[model samples]
Target chain A: GAGVSQTPSNKVTEKGKYVELRCDPISGHTALYWYRQSLGQGPEFLIYFQGTGAADDSGLPNDRFFAVRPEGSVSTLKIQRTERGDSAVYLCASSLMPNSPLHFGNGTRLTVT
Target chain B: GESVGLHLPTLSVQEGDNSIINCAYSNSASDYFIWYKQESGKGPQFIIDIRSNMDKRQGQRVTVLLNKTVKHLSLQIAATQPGDSAVYFCAEKGLDGATNKLIFGTGTLLAVQP
Candidate 1:
C-alpha cells in the first residue's frame, strides 16, 4: 500500500464487548505505532513496535488494551471489556525507522455504547 | 508523567493571513519535534519537523521555530487558506534512555474564515 492502512473504518460495539482493530503498515517499514485520539484531543501514543517486537508498551492505558505485530508488518490492537471511555479513534502509523517521520492511516473510529 | 501542551486551544484567522500555533514542552531531553495537521474524520498528517540542535526550519509555506531556552515550539503558516482549517498538533520525541515515543500535545483548532 502507498500508506498505512487500517481496517473497519468505523466500529460500534456495546460496552464490555471485545473488539479488535487491525493495521497494515507500508511495506518495508520497520516501525509501527498505535495511538488513541479522543474527541477534541490529539492522538495519544498507545504502543510502538520496532520490527516484530514491542519496544514500548508503557503508553497502553491498562490491561484491557493490548497490541501485537506478528510479522513486523500487520498489527492488531485488542481491547477487552471495552468501556464507554474507550470510544475513540484508533490510529496507526508507520515509519522507516524509529524517530523518523510517520505515515498515518485514516484510522478506525471505535464507538463503545 | 511528562507531557507536551499547547498554549492555545483555538485560533481563528482570516483567509490570506498568517497563522501561528504555539506549543510548550517540559522535557528538555526531547530532541525531535513535529507538527501535524488533522482534518475532520481523518488522521493527522505530517507538516514539518525540527531537531533540537536547530532553532528554525522551513517547508513549503510552513516554518517551524524552536526556542530551547523557553522550551517553546511554534508553527507558522504563511497565507492561511480556508482549506487549512484543521486541528494542529505538536509532538515531541525524547532522546532519553531508550524511549523513542512521540508525545503529542493537546492540539489547537485553526479556523480560517473567508
Candidate 2:
C-alpha cells in the first residue's frame, strides 16, 4: 500500500474483553511502531519493531498490552482484560528506516465500556 | 526516562500571519528531530526534520530551529493559512548504536483564523 493502514477504525468492547488491532505498514519499510493517543493529548509511544523482532517494548503500559510483527510487514496489538482507561486511539506508523520520518495511519479508536 | 514538553498549549493566528510554536526537550543525547501536523480526525503528517548537527532547516512554508544548548526547539510557519490549522508536535530521536527511537512532545494547537 502507499501508506500505513490500520484495521477496525473504531472498536467498542466491554471491560475485561480482549481486543486486537492490526496494522499493515508500507511495503519494504523496515521499522514499525505502535502508539496510543488519549483524548486531548499527543500520541504516546507503545512499542517499536525493527524487521520481525521487537527492538523496543519498554513503552507498553503493562503486561496486559502486547504487540507483534511476525512477518516484518503486518503487526498486531493485543490488549488482554481491557480496562476503561484503555479507551483511546491506537496509532500505527512505519518508516523506511530507523530515525526516518514516520508515516502514520488513521488509527483505531478503541472504546472500552 | 526522557520527556518532551510544549511551552504553549494553544496559539491563534490570523490568516497569512506568521506563527511560531515552541517546545522543550530534556534529552540532550537525541540526534534527530521532526515536526508533525495533525488535524482533527486524522493522523500526524510529517512537516520537516532537522538533525542535531544543523541549527536550522527550512521547508516549503515551514522551518524548524533546534537549540541543543538550551534543549529547545521551535517550529515557524510562514504565511499561516486556515488549512494549516492543526496541532503541531515536535519529536526527538535518540540513537542507540544503529537503532533510533522517537520521543514526542506535548502538542500545541494552532488555530489560524481567517
Best by lDDT: 1
- Give the proportion of true interface contacts each model preserves, from 0 to 1: 0.65, 0.57
Across B1-114, the per-residue lDDT of candidate 1 in tens digits comes to 422333448899999999999999878888899999999998899999999999999999999999999999999999999999999999998766488788899888999999
Error of 2 at B100 (Å): 2.9
Error of 2 at A53 (Å): 0.5
In CAPRI terms, model 1 is classed as medium
lDDT of each: 0.92, 0.90
RMSD per prediction, one decimal? 3.7, 3.8
Superposed model 1: Cα runs more than 4 Å off: B1-8
Question: TM-score of the candidate numbered 2?
Answer: 0.94
TM-score versus the correct structure, for each prediction:
0.94, 0.94
lDDT of 2 by residue, B1-114 (tens): 322333448999999999999999878888788998999888899999998989999999988999999999999999999999999989987766544567888799999999
User: For model 2, what fraction of the real interface contacts is kept?
Assistant: 0.57
